[model samples]
Target: MNIAVSIAIPDDEEKQTELSFDELSDRAKEKARDNYRQNYPDDGWWDSSYEDFDKIADMMGICIATKQVPLMNGKNKSVPAIYFSGFWCQGDGACFEGNWYPEKDPLASLTKVMGHAPNDADLHEIAFGLAHLSERCNQLIPEARVKVEHNSRYYHSNSVSYDIDLPMPIHIQEGNELQHMVFDGLRTKLDLDDEAFETEVSDLLRRFMDWMYGLLEEEHEHLTSDEVIDQYLEEMKFDEDGEAIY
Candidate 1:
Protein backbone atom coordinates (compact mmCIF):
# COMPACT_ATOMS: atom_id res chain seq x y z
CA MET A 1 0.00 0.00 0.00
CA ASN A 2 2.98 2.26 -0.19
CA ILE A 3 3.60 4.18 -3.46
CA ALA A 4 6.96 5.62 -4.52
CA VAL A 5 8.67 7.65 -7.27
CA SER A 6 12.19 8.77 -8.22
CA ILE A 7 13.37 12.12 -9.58
CA ALA A 8 16.79 10.78 -10.49
CA ILE A 9 15.51 9.49 -13.84
CA PRO A 10 16.57 5.92 -12.87
CA ASP A 11 15.60 5.83 -9.18
CA ASP A 12 12.98 6.73 -6.48
CA GLU A 13 11.90 6.93 -2.79
CA GLU A 14 8.93 8.38 -0.93
CA LYS A 15 8.85 11.52 1.25
CA GLN A 16 5.79 11.29 3.47
CA THR A 17 2.18 10.10 3.19
CA GLU A 18 0.95 13.32 4.76
CA LEU A 19 1.58 15.08 1.48
CA SER A 20 -1.49 14.62 -0.70
CA PHE A 21 -1.23 14.33 -4.50
CA ASP A 22 -2.99 17.72 -4.76
CA GLU A 23 -0.31 19.41 -2.67
CA LEU A 24 2.09 18.75 -5.52
CA SER A 25 1.45 20.16 -9.00
CA ASP A 26 3.04 20.73 -12.41
CA ARG A 27 6.34 18.82 -12.69
CA ALA A 28 6.15 17.43 -9.16
CA LYS A 29 2.68 15.90 -9.59
CA GLU A 30 3.24 14.69 -13.15
CA LYS A 31 6.49 13.03 -12.07
CA ALA A 32 4.67 11.47 -9.12
CA ARG A 33 1.98 10.04 -11.38
CA ASP A 34 4.58 8.74 -13.84
CA ASN A 35 6.46 7.03 -11.02
CA TYR A 36 3.23 5.57 -9.67
CA ARG A 37 2.32 4.31 -13.10
CA GLN A 38 5.75 2.73 -13.67
CA ASN A 39 5.69 0.62 -10.51
CA TYR A 40 2.03 -0.37 -10.25
CA PRO A 41 0.01 -0.47 -13.42
CA ASP A 42 -3.74 -0.92 -13.54
CA ASP A 43 -3.44 -4.40 -15.01
CA GLY A 44 -0.16 -5.41 -13.42
CA TRP A 45 2.34 -4.61 -16.16
CA TRP A 46 4.63 -6.87 -14.20
CA ASP A 47 2.60 -9.94 -15.10
CA SER A 48 4.22 -12.97 -16.73
CA SER A 49 4.83 -12.73 -20.48
CA TYR A 50 5.84 -14.85 -23.42
CA GLU A 51 9.53 -14.29 -24.19
CA ASP A 52 10.43 -14.89 -27.83
CA PHE A 53 14.18 -15.51 -27.42
CA ASP A 54 14.86 -16.79 -30.89
CA LYS A 55 13.03 -13.78 -32.13
CA ILE A 56 15.05 -11.65 -29.76
CA ALA A 57 18.27 -13.30 -30.91
CA ASP A 58 17.41 -12.82 -34.53
CA MET A 59 16.57 -9.23 -33.81
CA MET A 60 20.01 -8.78 -32.35
CA GLY A 61 21.41 -10.71 -35.31
CA ILE A 62 22.68 -13.64 -33.24
CA CYS A 63 23.65 -16.69 -35.26
CA ILE A 64 20.58 -18.82 -35.93
CA ALA A 65 21.75 -21.51 -38.35
CA THR A 66 21.05 -24.12 -35.67
CA LYS A 67 17.67 -22.61 -34.77
CA GLN A 68 17.93 -24.72 -31.62
CA VAL A 69 18.96 -22.75 -28.55
CA PRO A 70 18.87 -24.34 -25.06
CA LEU A 71 15.48 -22.73 -25.07
CA MET A 72 12.94 -24.67 -27.09
CA ASN A 73 9.53 -23.68 -25.72
CA GLY A 74 10.45 -20.03 -25.64
CA LYS A 75 11.52 -18.04 -22.54
CA ASN A 76 9.55 -15.60 -20.41
CA LYS A 77 9.70 -12.14 -18.79
CA SER A 78 12.30 -10.79 -21.21
CA VAL A 79 13.89 -7.51 -20.19
CA PRO A 80 12.80 -4.26 -21.77
CA ALA A 81 14.37 -4.02 -25.25
CA ILE A 82 15.97 -0.85 -24.04
CA TYR A 83 18.42 -3.06 -22.14
CA PHE A 84 20.13 -4.88 -25.00
CA SER A 85 22.84 -4.76 -27.70
CA GLY A 86 24.59 -7.09 -30.18
CA PHE A 87 28.10 -8.51 -30.59
CA TRP A 88 30.42 -9.06 -33.55
CA CYS A 89 30.83 -12.48 -35.10
CA GLN A 90 33.85 -14.67 -35.90
CA GLY A 91 35.10 -16.30 -39.07
CA ASP A 92 33.78 -19.59 -37.70
CA GLY A 93 30.21 -18.20 -37.55
CA ALA A 94 29.39 -19.98 -34.29
CA CYS A 95 27.52 -17.01 -32.86
CA PHE A 96 25.24 -17.08 -35.87
CA GLU A 97 24.97 -20.87 -35.65
CA GLY A 98 23.95 -20.56 -32.01
CA ASN A 99 26.94 -22.69 -31.09
CA TRP A 100 29.10 -20.11 -29.39
CA TYR A 101 29.93 -19.99 -25.71
CA PRO A 102 29.70 -16.70 -23.83
CA GLU A 103 33.00 -17.31 -22.12
CA LYS A 104 34.83 -18.34 -25.26
CA ASP A 105 33.36 -16.60 -28.27
CA PRO A 106 35.48 -14.48 -30.61
CA LEU A 107 33.25 -11.44 -31.30
CA ALA A 108 35.39 -8.45 -30.69
CA SER A 109 34.32 -6.49 -33.79
CA LEU A 110 30.60 -7.21 -34.31
CA THR A 111 27.98 -4.47 -34.41
CA LYS A 112 24.84 -6.36 -33.39
CA VAL A 113 24.33 -6.31 -29.61
CA MET A 114 21.71 -7.50 -27.12
CA GLY A 115 20.66 -6.72 -23.53
CA HIS A 116 21.67 -9.00 -20.69
CA ALA A 117 21.41 -8.84 -16.88
CA PRO A 118 24.67 -8.00 -15.11
CA ASN A 119 24.28 -11.46 -13.63
CA ASP A 120 21.95 -14.42 -14.04
CA ALA A 121 19.34 -13.32 -11.42
CA ASP A 122 17.79 -11.35 -14.29
CA LEU A 123 16.88 -14.50 -16.21
CA HIS A 124 13.81 -15.19 -14.05
CA GLU A 125 10.88 -12.85 -14.32
CA ILE A 126 10.30 -11.75 -10.70
CA ALA A 127 6.83 -10.13 -10.66
CA PHE A 128 8.54 -7.72 -13.06
CA GLY A 129 8.80 -3.97 -12.34
CA LEU A 130 12.40 -3.69 -11.23
CA ALA A 131 11.93 -6.05 -8.29
CA HIS A 132 15.54 -6.86 -7.29
CA LEU A 133 16.90 -3.75 -8.96
CA SER A 134 17.55 -2.27 -5.54
CA GLU A 135 19.20 -5.25 -3.90
CA ARG A 136 21.92 -5.65 -6.54
CA CYS A 137 22.36 -1.91 -6.60
CA ASN A 138 22.75 -1.42 -2.83
CA GLN A 139 26.53 -1.89 -2.75
CA LEU A 140 27.04 0.28 -5.80
CA ILE A 141 24.48 3.04 -5.12
CA PRO A 142 26.67 4.85 -2.62
CA GLU A 143 29.34 5.12 -5.28
CA ALA A 144 27.16 6.04 -8.29
CA ARG A 145 27.36 2.73 -10.15
CA VAL A 146 23.92 1.39 -11.08
CA LYS A 147 24.55 -0.23 -14.48
CA VAL A 148 27.10 -2.67 -13.09
CA GLU A 149 24.49 -4.84 -11.42
CA HIS A 150 22.41 -5.02 -14.59
CA ASN A 151 25.38 -6.30 -16.61
CA SER A 152 24.91 -9.95 -15.63
CA ARG A 153 27.66 -10.91 -18.04
CA TYR A 154 30.55 -11.00 -15.61
CA TYR A 155 31.07 -12.30 -12.12
CA HIS A 156 33.71 -9.68 -11.33
CA SER A 157 35.21 -8.34 -14.53
CA ASN A 158 36.46 -4.77 -14.25
CA SER A 159 33.54 -3.50 -16.34
CA VAL A 160 32.63 0.06 -17.14
CA SER A 161 29.55 -0.01 -14.91
CA TYR A 162 31.80 0.84 -12.00
CA ASP A 163 32.52 4.10 -13.74
CA ILE A 164 28.90 5.19 -13.68
CA ASP A 165 27.33 6.80 -10.62
CA LEU A 166 23.87 6.15 -9.15
CA PRO A 167 23.65 8.57 -6.24
CA MET A 168 20.08 9.32 -5.08
CA PRO A 169 19.24 11.63 -2.24
CA ILE A 170 18.10 9.64 0.80
CA HIS A 171 14.70 11.26 0.36
CA ILE A 172 14.29 9.30 -2.88
CA GLN A 173 15.84 6.14 -1.44
CA GLU A 174 12.41 5.08 -0.18
CA GLY A 175 11.25 4.74 -3.78
CA ASN A 176 13.43 1.67 -4.05
CA GLU A 177 11.35 -1.50 -3.72
CA LEU A 178 13.68 -2.84 -1.00
CA GLN A 179 13.59 0.31 1.09
CA HIS A 180 9.85 0.58 0.57
CA MET A 181 9.42 -3.01 1.76
CA VAL A 182 11.39 -2.27 4.89
CA PHE A 183 9.54 1.00 5.47
CA ASP A 184 6.08 -0.41 4.78
CA GLY A 185 6.47 -3.75 6.56
CA LEU A 186 5.18 -5.89 3.67
CA ARG A 187 4.07 -9.01 5.57
CA THR A 188 0.70 -7.91 6.99
CA LYS A 189 -0.64 -6.04 3.95
CA LEU A 190 -2.19 -8.47 1.39
CA ASP A 191 -5.38 -10.07 2.69
CA LEU A 192 -9.10 -9.12 2.74
CA ASP A 193 -8.45 -5.92 0.83
CA ASP A 194 -7.90 -7.84 -2.39
CA GLU A 195 -11.44 -7.73 -3.79
CA ALA A 196 -11.76 -3.96 -3.48
CA PHE A 197 -8.26 -3.33 -4.82
CA GLU A 198 -8.13 -5.72 -7.77
CA THR A 199 -10.16 -3.70 -10.22
CA GLU A 200 -8.33 -0.45 -9.56
CA VAL A 201 -4.97 -2.11 -10.15
CA SER A 202 -6.29 -3.76 -13.30
CA ASP A 203 -7.39 -0.44 -14.74
CA LEU A 204 -4.11 1.21 -13.89
CA LEU A 205 -2.37 -1.43 -15.97
CA ARG A 206 -4.13 -0.66 -19.24
CA ARG A 207 -2.38 2.70 -19.32
CA PHE A 208 1.01 1.04 -19.87
CA MET A 209 0.00 -1.39 -22.62
CA ASP A 210 0.98 1.16 -25.20
CA TRP A 211 4.33 1.60 -23.54
CA MET A 212 5.07 -2.14 -23.46
CA TYR A 213 4.10 -2.65 -27.06
CA GLY A 214 6.29 0.26 -28.07
CA LEU A 215 9.23 -1.27 -26.22
CA LEU A 216 8.70 -4.64 -27.89
CA GLU A 217 8.44 -3.11 -31.29
CA GLU A 218 11.52 -1.00 -30.69
CA GLU A 219 13.51 -4.01 -29.53
CA HIS A 220 12.53 -5.83 -32.67
CA GLU A 221 13.66 -2.98 -34.84
CA HIS A 222 16.40 -3.68 -37.40
CA LEU A 223 18.60 -1.13 -35.64
CA THR A 224 18.53 -0.15 -31.94
CA SER A 225 20.28 0.66 -28.66
CA ASP A 226 20.08 -3.01 -27.64
CA GLU A 227 22.70 -3.79 -30.29
CA VAL A 228 25.22 -2.08 -28.05
CA ILE A 229 24.08 -3.74 -24.83
CA ASP A 230 24.28 -7.14 -26.47
CA GLN A 231 27.79 -6.33 -27.64
CA TYR A 232 28.80 -5.98 -24.01
CA LEU A 233 26.89 -9.08 -22.96
CA GLU A 234 28.93 -10.86 -25.61
CA GLU A 235 32.03 -10.62 -23.45
CA MET A 236 30.38 -13.44 -21.52
CA LYS A 237 28.60 -15.14 -24.43
CA PHE A 238 25.18 -14.47 -22.82
CA ASP A 239 22.12 -14.87 -24.99
CA GLU A 240 18.83 -13.03 -25.21
CA ASP A 241 17.39 -15.02 -22.31
CA GLY A 242 20.44 -14.13 -20.28
CA GLU A 243 21.51 -17.75 -20.53
CA ALA A 244 24.97 -18.67 -21.75
CA ILE A 245 24.25 -19.37 -25.42
CA TYR A 246 26.70 -22.29 -25.52
Candidate 2:
Protein backbone atom coordinates (compact mmCIF):
# COMPACT_ATOMS: atom_id res chain seq x y z
CA MET A 1 0.00 0.00 0.00
CA ASN A 2 2.93 2.33 0.62
CA ILE A 3 4.16 1.73 -2.88
CA ALA A 4 3.92 5.30 -4.05
CA VAL A 5 4.90 6.29 -7.51
CA SER A 6 4.90 9.83 -8.75
CA ILE A 7 3.03 10.28 -12.00
CA ALA A 8 2.88 13.99 -11.80
CA ILE A 9 2.33 15.66 -15.13
CA PRO A 10 4.78 18.47 -15.31
CA ASP A 11 3.72 22.01 -16.03
CA ASP A 12 4.45 23.47 -19.45
CA GLU A 13 7.91 24.46 -18.33
CA GLU A 14 8.68 21.05 -16.84
CA LYS A 15 7.03 19.31 -19.79
CA GLN A 16 9.17 21.16 -22.27
CA THR A 17 12.28 19.77 -20.53
CA GLU A 18 10.93 16.46 -19.36
CA LEU A 19 13.04 13.37 -19.89
CA SER A 20 11.63 10.03 -20.79
CA PHE A 21 11.65 7.45 -18.01
CA ASP A 22 13.76 5.09 -20.07
CA GLU A 23 16.23 7.73 -21.27
CA LEU A 24 16.85 9.74 -18.14
CA SER A 25 20.61 10.13 -17.59
CA ASP A 26 22.40 9.88 -14.28
CA ARG A 27 22.39 13.64 -13.86
CA ALA A 28 18.66 13.91 -14.60
CA LYS A 29 17.83 11.16 -12.16
CA GLU A 30 20.01 12.77 -9.54
CA LYS A 31 18.44 16.12 -10.18
CA ALA A 32 15.00 14.59 -9.84
CA ARG A 33 16.03 13.10 -6.52
CA ASP A 34 17.46 16.37 -5.26
CA ASN A 35 14.45 18.27 -6.50
CA TYR A 36 12.13 15.86 -4.73
CA ARG A 37 14.09 16.24 -1.55
CA GLN A 38 14.04 20.00 -1.78
CA ASN A 39 10.38 20.17 -2.73
CA TYR A 40 8.93 17.45 -0.59
CA PRO A 41 11.54 17.28 2.18
CA ASP A 42 9.46 14.73 3.95
CA ASP A 43 9.94 11.25 5.31
CA GLY A 44 8.44 8.18 3.57
CA TRP A 45 8.76 9.73 0.16
CA TRP A 46 9.71 7.04 -2.28
CA ASP A 47 11.76 7.58 -5.41
CA SER A 48 10.01 9.52 -8.11
CA SER A 49 10.02 8.28 -11.67
CA TYR A 50 7.90 8.31 -14.77
CA GLU A 51 5.61 5.59 -15.97
CA ASP A 52 4.25 5.54 -19.50
CA PHE A 53 2.35 8.78 -19.71
CA ASP A 54 -0.80 7.17 -21.02
CA LYS A 55 -0.72 4.38 -18.44
CA ILE A 56 -0.19 6.91 -15.74
CA ALA A 57 -3.13 8.85 -17.02
CA ASP A 58 -5.27 5.76 -17.05
CA MET A 59 -4.30 4.87 -13.51
CA MET A 60 -4.98 8.41 -12.40
CA GLY A 61 -8.52 8.05 -13.61
CA ILE A 62 -9.15 5.14 -11.25
CA CYS A 63 -11.77 5.43 -8.51
CA ILE A 64 -12.34 3.34 -5.43
CA ALA A 65 -15.40 2.53 -3.31
CA THR A 66 -16.37 0.56 -0.23
CA LYS A 67 -19.81 -0.83 0.47
CA GLN A 68 -21.62 -2.87 3.09
CA VAL A 69 -24.24 -4.99 1.35
CA PRO A 70 -26.58 -7.39 3.03
CA LEU A 71 -26.79 -10.89 1.63
CA MET A 72 -30.18 -11.93 0.33
CA ASN A 73 -29.64 -15.44 1.57
CA GLY A 74 -28.43 -17.30 4.65
CA LYS A 75 -30.29 -15.30 7.23
CA ASN A 76 -29.44 -12.08 5.41
CA LYS A 77 -25.80 -11.65 6.38
CA SER A 78 -23.90 -8.54 5.42
CA VAL A 79 -20.37 -8.28 4.10
CA PRO A 80 -17.76 -5.71 3.13
CA ALA A 81 -16.84 -5.08 -0.49
CA ILE A 82 -14.26 -2.88 -2.19
CA TYR A 83 -13.97 -1.76 -5.78
CA PHE A 84 -11.57 0.03 -8.13
CA SER A 85 -12.76 1.27 -11.47
CA GLY A 86 -12.71 4.11 -13.96
CA PHE A 87 -12.83 5.25 -17.52
CA TRP A 88 -9.64 5.73 -19.50
CA CYS A 89 -9.05 7.07 -22.97
CA GLN A 90 -5.64 5.49 -23.41
CA GLY A 91 -6.76 1.88 -23.33
CA ASP A 92 -10.00 0.25 -22.32
CA GLY A 93 -12.87 2.70 -22.24
CA ALA A 94 -13.87 1.59 -18.77
CA CYS A 95 -12.26 -0.95 -16.53
CA PHE A 96 -13.04 -2.21 -13.02
CA GLU A 97 -12.53 -5.07 -10.64
CA GLY A 98 -12.55 -5.71 -6.89
CA ASN A 99 -12.68 -8.22 -4.08
CA TRP A 100 -14.75 -8.95 -0.98
CA TYR A 101 -13.93 -10.64 2.27
CA PRO A 102 -16.53 -13.18 3.27
CA GLU A 103 -17.54 -13.73 6.85
CA LYS A 104 -14.96 -15.90 8.60
CA ASP A 105 -17.50 -18.27 10.09
CA PRO A 106 -20.53 -17.94 7.90
CA LEU A 107 -22.26 -21.11 9.05
CA ALA A 108 -21.61 -20.19 12.62
CA SER A 109 -22.85 -16.71 11.96
CA LEU A 110 -25.99 -18.25 10.46
CA THR A 111 -26.49 -20.56 13.39
CA LYS A 112 -26.04 -17.74 15.81
CA VAL A 113 -28.53 -15.66 13.88
CA MET A 114 -31.00 -18.22 12.62
CA GLY A 115 -30.80 -20.86 15.40
CA HIS A 116 -29.64 -23.57 13.01
CA ALA A 117 -27.28 -24.20 10.15
CA PRO A 118 -28.88 -23.17 6.90
CA ASN A 119 -30.13 -25.87 4.57
CA ASP A 120 -28.94 -26.14 0.98
CA ALA A 121 -31.50 -23.65 -0.29
CA ASP A 122 -30.55 -21.12 2.37
CA LEU A 123 -26.88 -21.56 1.61
CA HIS A 124 -27.51 -21.13 -2.10
CA GLU A 125 -29.48 -17.98 -1.47
CA ILE A 126 -26.72 -16.58 0.70
CA ALA A 127 -24.08 -17.25 -1.91
CA PHE A 128 -26.25 -15.74 -4.59
CA GLY A 129 -27.04 -12.66 -2.56
CA LEU A 130 -23.46 -12.08 -1.53
CA ALA A 131 -22.28 -12.32 -5.10
CA HIS A 132 -25.08 -10.17 -6.36
CA LEU A 133 -24.40 -7.59 -3.67
CA SER A 134 -20.71 -7.43 -4.50
CA GLU A 135 -21.41 -6.93 -8.16
CA ARG A 136 -24.07 -4.32 -7.48
CA CYS A 137 -21.85 -2.47 -5.00
CA ASN A 138 -19.04 -2.26 -7.49
CA GLN A 139 -21.30 -1.22 -10.32
CA LEU A 140 -23.31 1.26 -8.27
CA ILE A 141 -20.57 3.03 -6.31
CA PRO A 142 -17.90 5.02 -8.10
CA GLU A 143 -14.95 7.20 -7.10
CA ALA A 144 -15.51 6.33 -3.46
CA ARG A 145 -12.86 4.75 -1.29
CA VAL A 146 -13.69 2.07 1.21
CA LYS A 147 -12.43 2.19 4.77
CA VAL A 148 -9.88 -0.44 5.69
CA GLU A 149 -7.73 -1.43 8.64
CA HIS A 150 -4.67 -0.51 6.60
CA ASN A 151 -3.73 0.43 3.08
CA SER A 152 -2.44 -2.95 1.96
CA ARG A 153 -3.31 -5.62 -0.54
CA TYR A 154 -4.64 -8.97 0.52
CA TYR A 155 -2.32 -11.21 -1.44
CA HIS A 156 -3.32 -14.64 -2.55
CA SER A 157 -1.39 -17.67 -3.76
CA ASN A 158 -2.36 -16.84 -7.33
CA SER A 159 -0.55 -13.51 -7.00
CA VAL A 160 -3.78 -11.57 -7.36
CA SER A 161 -4.62 -9.09 -4.66
CA TYR A 162 -6.86 -6.19 -3.73
CA ASP A 163 -6.08 -3.14 -1.62
CA ILE A 164 -7.82 -3.21 1.72
CA ASP A 165 -9.12 -0.10 3.40
CA LEU A 166 -10.62 0.72 6.77
CA PRO A 167 -14.13 -0.20 7.80
CA MET A 168 -17.02 1.46 5.98
CA PRO A 169 -19.81 3.24 7.82
CA ILE A 170 -22.34 0.91 9.36
CA HIS A 171 -25.95 1.73 8.47
CA ILE A 172 -28.60 -0.35 10.14
CA GLN A 173 -31.33 -0.15 7.54
CA GLU A 174 -35.10 -0.56 7.63
CA GLY A 175 -36.57 -3.85 6.37
CA ASN A 176 -33.00 -5.06 5.87
CA GLU A 177 -32.29 -8.73 6.19
CA LEU A 178 -28.85 -8.03 7.61
CA GLN A 179 -30.27 -5.74 10.26
CA HIS A 180 -32.94 -8.17 11.45
CA MET A 181 -30.55 -11.09 11.48
CA VAL A 182 -27.90 -9.17 13.41
CA PHE A 183 -30.37 -7.77 15.94
CA ASP A 184 -32.04 -11.10 16.43
CA GLY A 185 -28.71 -12.80 16.92
CA LEU A 186 -27.58 -10.24 19.44
CA ARG A 187 -30.92 -10.30 21.21
CA THR A 188 -30.78 -14.00 21.73
CA LYS A 189 -27.09 -14.11 22.45
CA LEU A 190 -27.11 -11.32 25.00
CA ASP A 191 -30.71 -11.72 26.23
CA LEU A 192 -31.43 -8.04 25.66
CA ASP A 193 -34.33 -6.35 23.92
CA ASP A 194 -34.87 -2.84 22.69
CA GLU A 195 -38.30 -1.92 21.45
CA ALA A 196 -36.95 0.53 18.91
CA PHE A 197 -34.53 -1.96 17.35
CA GLU A 198 -36.71 -2.54 14.29
CA THR A 199 -37.22 1.13 13.69
CA GLU A 200 -33.55 1.90 14.02
CA VAL A 201 -32.64 -0.93 11.68
CA SER A 202 -35.24 0.15 9.15
CA ASP A 203 -34.03 3.72 9.14
CA LEU A 204 -30.44 2.71 8.50
CA LEU A 205 -31.30 0.33 5.68
CA ARG A 206 -33.61 2.82 4.03
CA ARG A 207 -31.02 5.57 4.12
CA PHE A 208 -28.29 3.39 2.70
CA MET A 209 -30.44 1.86 0.00
CA ASP A 210 -31.81 5.22 -0.99
CA TRP A 211 -28.33 6.64 -1.26
CA MET A 212 -27.18 3.66 -3.32
CA TYR A 213 -30.17 3.87 -5.65
CA GLY A 214 -29.50 7.55 -6.21
CA LEU A 215 -25.91 6.84 -7.12
CA LEU A 216 -26.99 3.97 -9.34
CA GLU A 217 -29.34 6.27 -11.20
CA GLU A 218 -26.69 8.92 -11.59
CA GLU A 219 -24.27 6.36 -12.99
CA HIS A 220 -26.93 5.01 -15.28
CA GLU A 221 -27.39 8.41 -16.89
CA HIS A 222 -23.76 8.30 -18.01
CA LEU A 223 -24.05 5.09 -19.98
CA THR A 224 -26.11 3.78 -22.86
CA SER A 225 -28.70 1.09 -22.38
CA ASP A 226 -26.42 -1.45 -24.03
CA GLU A 227 -23.52 -0.62 -21.76
CA VAL A 228 -25.70 -0.96 -18.72
CA ILE A 229 -27.04 -4.26 -19.83
CA ASP A 230 -23.55 -5.47 -20.70
CA GLN A 231 -22.24 -4.54 -17.29
CA TYR A 232 -25.16 -6.21 -15.59
CA LEU A 233 -24.66 -9.42 -17.52
CA GLU A 234 -20.94 -9.35 -16.93
CA GLU A 235 -21.33 -9.01 -13.17
CA MET A 236 -24.23 -11.43 -12.82
CA LYS A 237 -23.39 -14.91 -11.59
CA PHE A 238 -26.04 -17.56 -11.62
CA ASP A 239 -26.43 -20.85 -9.84
CA GLU A 240 -27.99 -24.14 -10.98
CA ASP A 241 -31.24 -23.19 -9.33
CA GLY A 242 -31.48 -19.99 -11.39
CA GLU A 243 -30.19 -18.01 -8.46
CA ALA A 244 -27.46 -15.42 -8.79
CA ILE A 245 -24.23 -16.57 -7.17
CA TYR A 246 -21.41 -14.37 -5.97
Please provide, for model 2 over 1-246, each residue's C-alpha lDDT reduced to its tens digit, 9 standing for 90 to 100: 599788876685462332332244555434433433332323211112111211221222212233344445745422223222222222212212332333233343334323332343433343343333333233322222321222334211122223433222255566698876875665444322233322322232223223323333344344424343334334444322323333
Each model's TM-score?
0.17, 0.17
CA lDDT, every model vs. true structure: 0.29, 0.32
- Per lDDT, the best of the predicted structures is 2
Tens-digit lDDT track of model 1 for 1-246 = 998976574334543233333343445544443433343323322222214433433332222232222334675433322222222222110011121111112132111222342232322222121222222223223222212122344211111121123344376475588775543432124211223223322221222222333343444342223343334333433222233333
Q: What is residue 56's positional error in candidate 1, in angstroms? A: 6.4
Error of 2 at 84 (Å): 17
C-alpha root-mean-square deviation, each candidate? 31.2, 25.8
Could you give me the TM-score of model 1 versus the true structure? 0.17
